[model samples]
Target: MSDRKPINDAMDHMNGIEGYPTNVDLKSLPKPLRYFGYFFISFFVLFFITFFVLSMIL
Candidate 1:
């Protein structure tokens, strides 16, 4: 007898856990949070670029 059903029907959230947010909605966030996200992403880009440029120069 098959007793197991689908773990998650939609499987949209993380690990198919209900009510677990998988992502941050940038459009829904307030202005400050949106800017912070942009800044956080830019920091990574600049950090890698700086290291690469320095390695090439040295």
Candidate 2:
């Protein structure tokens, strides 16, 4: 039973598509500004959600 389990798991992984995009493509932006751009966008989204919730509660 244990030996059959390993073969089943290996086959499952091999059956899927490989080499997919798993991270952000930072090189498309200017080097020094990429971090700031990501940070600014994330902060704006978080701030908007917080403000929206506060407004609804008050």
Find the candidate with the highest TM-score and give its number: 1
Superposed Cα deviation of residue 45, candidate 2 (Å):
0.6
After superposing all C-alphas onto the true structure, candidate 2 shows an RMSD in angstroms of 8.1
TM per candidate comes to 0.59, 0.46
Deviating ranges (above 4 Å) for candidate 2 = 1-26
Scored by lDDT, the top model is 1
**lDDT agreement with native, every candidate:** 0.73, 0.71
Error of 2 at 4 (Å): 58
Q: How close to the true structure is residue 29 of candidate 1, measured as C-alpha lDDT?
A: 88
Worst 10 residues of 2 by lDDT: 1-10
- Model 1: CA > 4 A from native: 1-5, 8-18, 22-24
* lDDT tens digits by residue: candidate 2, 1-58: 1223325765646644352344557687786698898889999999999999999999
**Model 2, 48: alpha-carbon shift in Å?**
0.6
lDDT of 1 by residue, 1-58 (tens): 1233446755544334544444556599899988999999999999999999999999
